[model samples]
Target: MIVRIMGEGQVRLDDVHLAELDELDDELLAETRSGDEEGFRRTLGALLDAVRRLGAPLPDDALEPSELILPSPDATLPEVREMLKDTDGLIPG
Candidate 1:
């Protein structure tokens, strides 16, 4: 699946990593819901790092639609909360 990290472009992640990503996504959701800013940041950073480490970076010119969209690394908690309200975490299960 193609995952987009806002403000950082896109990466193509394999389906094999979906389960692990989902677990991190769940942690992110819980952190956000409980207003745990530190935990949220840590989890978000881990999630993004996992994507960067495990996925292949797409060429800058690539225009494929992303299957998942994640917040920017510096995104505020409130921004993430608003984003989560519109979807089921960062990945569409």
Candidate 2:
């Protein structure tokens, strides 16, 4: 009930606060307070896996791991140059 209510945004939360809330899992917030280590570890592992999955590349035979596939249909020269600035020579454009 609390999770559903929180999810529905009855209360405001920051990213770090939400992350801590996820870690607590209804346990006390004090650092000295003992927590369910096994449960926390499992939850953390699952979260990490989910983040990795989210960052995974799309299904493409020619796509390499370092490739930065843009979502734009038609990118302007300035846009392409901006993206390439940080990438150095990773992209040939």
Candidate 3:
């Protein structure tokens, strides 16, 4: 799967990592739902960090479509809330 961290470059993640990412995605959604600002920050950062840790970064010029597009580390609660509204899971299925 190809994941894109907005404002950053793309990454290529294997299907094997999907379950782990899904867990992090759930945590992000929970934090947003609970309106826990700190949790949101921590979880969101952790989720993005996990993506970076587990996936291989694509070249800066890569043009493949991303399967999952996540918010940047500095994203705000409102921004994430808007993203979650898509109902595609944080990792977007």
By lDDT, who's the top model here? 1
Is candidate 1 or 2 superior in TM-score? 1
Off by more than 4 A, model 2: 1-34, 57-93
Number of clashes in model 1? 0
Show model 3 residue runs off by greater than 4 Å.
Answer: 86-88
Task: State model 3's lDDT.
Answer: 0.88
lDDT of 1: 0.93
Better of 1 and 3 by lDDT: 1
RMSD of 1: 0.9
Model 2: how far residue 37 lies from native, Å: 0.8
Compared with the true structure, what per-residue lDDT tens digits does model 3 show for residues 34-62?
89999999988889989999999999999
**Alpha-carbon deviation at 55 in model 3, angstroms:** 0.5
| Cα-based lDDT for every prediction | 0.93, 0.31, 0.88
Model 1: residues with Cα > 4 Å off, grouped in runs: none
